[model samples]
Target chain A: MSVPLLAPGDRVLVKDDWPEFRGPAHIRTPHYLRGKPGRVVRVLGGFANPEDLAFARPAPKRVLYHVVFERPPLWHEGEAGDDVLVEIFEHWLQPVPAERQAA
Target chain B: MSTPARPESLARLDRLVAALIAKGIVTESDLVEAQARTDRASPEVGARMVARAWLDPDWRRLLLGNGAEAAEHMGVSMAGAPPLGVLEDTATLHHLVVCTLCSCYPRAVLGYPPSWYKSFEYRSRAVRDPRGVLAEWGTTLAAGCRVRVVDSTADYRWMVLPMRPAGTEGWSEDQLAALVTRDVLVGVALPRLPVALAAE
Candidate 1:
């Protein structure tokens, strides 16, 4: 198993790029959550990449993390302090800069 | 004896099952038994877990820590499914579960996903306006309470552990379980003490 790149309590930003698959794409990350900033709640271990598995290909394991984002950023009329916790794979996450971690 | 013809709608499923059986991956009996198990699954299985958690703190810890194992302890088999996660509802925090991408549910505990849960309208509105959705379902939280919308997007499935309703202090596990419904486990509703029980 590959060591997880991120840990719980780490603030990360969801990658805004869409996965480029030739055919029969099975992307798990919701389009709405892309580019959102969230804090990692837990390391949910590794699993065979669904993007590859959906096509019946031999896939490598990818680390999955439970991340929590405040609802205000996720929805226009979202309540303050209300949160949305989403399970995001490691490839879709990037470390939030030190300057922005306090936000 | 000969096998009866299967429905045209089941052609794709029949072919897939035949292929798996041909490859020795699984037998016809295995599929039958699996279907039987799935048919037996219901919200009552999940509600029992909730009721047990309310009565036993240790079991509650187990339920929150490892939901699949907790289900197995309660005689519910979670074989061949993703891990289960139980979201606890506190006095200050409430959880609402949605699959914005598609219907990914804890089938072993709660059985099949409700049709409304898979609708595009619900999928789009749940995260965008959870409070509004809950209000439509007749669940209004206190002003200070916080809501958490859980998106079951990946390999881990989720269910809510709703706060146990009051006025049933000495109720049995069966009685407590009666208060929990499929909607309550999904976080759109809360367990309410029945009027007769409340007056007891």
Candidate 2:
């Protein structure tokens, strides 16, 4: 209902506890990127929250963010520094701390 | 695209089409036109744009910035389709397109969705481990290069404008386009040089 907290290019930490936080409910956030640190590549406007839409419930406009993660850090094995991208809902992300964001 | 789909699904589609026709919501001609439209939407359309972008700098800029406008200039029809997005691959940046939620593609420019693209394995992993997926397709980017994976959806559809390979100097647009396969358009593989294809 208010303005979105984060904008494009802000570093975000995806919350692992989503869609009931116990086991799993219908969700838009991918499983692998849970609790991972990544950077927002773009603010992809807003859409009906899929987290609620899955249950056929009314979903208000929610900001969508395109987040990018480096492969090696995100995964245990892979070439380092190659970026992986995903579109995640606003509720699924948290702003990283100021010091870590600066680094 | 020719891989056999389930017969029950095909029969269900036929029944749906029949219902539409009976209700006058659609006619046989409408189905025919839709079929023709999809048939015209092929990799060659994407390849043609890539070929022209290869030759013309301004055109490439226009193609990258606004794909629908560039497509109109090239006489490719994009009416009633979603906005187009062409992710340009450069020496430093590489791009891959996938619909992690569903199989959303630039079907107006790249024809029918490939079977592999719609597979659960690809939809599940492409966004999570793109470099590993690229490695599966024999594409390995350098350490410093950034691999951006774009998710195509209902609002925007994307295709890749792959970088031109070396050893093709003075080649005609057709020659360069000949090397641009559907996989290159999807960003799973690179356009092969003539020498590379010749060796195969």
* Highest TM-score against the true fold, candidate: 1
lDDT of 2 by residue, B86-121 (tens): 888988888888887678888877889888999988
TM-score, every prediction: 0.90, 0.79
Kindly list the per-residue Cα lDDT of model 1 for residues B83-138, writing each as its tens digit.
99999999999999999988898899999887899888889888889999999999
Residue A43 CA displacement from its true place in model 2, Å: 3.6
What's model 2's TM-score? 0.79
Tell me the whole-model lDDT of each prediction, alpha carbons only. Answer: 0.90, 0.80
Residues A31-55 of candidate 1 have per-residue lDDT tens digits of 8898998999999989899988999
Model 1 ranges with Cα > 4 A deviation: A20-24, B1-31
lDDT per residue for candidate 2 within A1-103, as digits (tens), equals 4477887778899997755567546766666678999888777667777666777889898887778876655677655556777777788899998899888
Model 2 RMSD to the real structure? 3.9
